[model samples]
Target: MTISNLQEVKSRITVFGQPMICRGCSHEVFIPYELYINVEKPGIGCLYAHDIAICQNCGEARHFSDPSDFDNEKGIFVWALRQYVC
Candidate 1:
């Protein structure tokens, strides 16, 4: 499918060889999105990027850690924001 159609595919998205199923409605389709979570606190939180999929049926979101890890394996995987959601 084309990138434009990807959001509408409504099909199972696999992560690490596993199918993503929505737990809220048992839906097999999702709208893929990338999100960053603040893993740090007290100061500038660690903005870890994640590959997220939102259930098209129930609006539930599931996240999968990005494999890149910004090429850092240590130091809590710190990195700068490089992804844009909108």
Candidate 2:
């Protein structure tokens, strides 16, 4: 499950939007949680890290690969959950 090339791993999963307002309570504050994917193959290895924003008022969560990606009118986050070996 080791990834040979870091670039080979790609994700196109948009979890949520920026300034993520809690759908439950319309809360603006959120708590961030770190996420990581670990790959272990015969001759390759890779580790990808991401973040998930959780609303403090409503406890809703959204996933994003990069924090900076959230700074936009429409936040589009991608995922790299798959591993590629070379």
Q: What is the TM-score of each predicted model, taking all chains together?
A: 0.49, 0.41
lDDT of 2 by residue, 1-86 (tens): 11122232222222233344566787655555566667666456576666665665566776544422333555654433322222
lDDT of 1 at 70: 36
lDDT at residue 62 of model 1 (Cα atoms): 74
Error of 2 at 69 (Å): 8.8
Q: Residue 86: error of model 2 in Å?
A: 46
Q: What is candidate 2's CA lDDT for residue 78?
A: 40
Compare the candidates by TM-score and give the number of the best one.
Answer: 1
User: What's model 2's overall lDDT?
Assistant: 0.45
Candidate 2, after superposition: displacement of residue 78 in Å?
19
After superposing candidate 2 on the true structure, give the runs of residues whose Cα lies further than 4 Å from its correct spot. Answer: 1-18, 39-45, 67-86
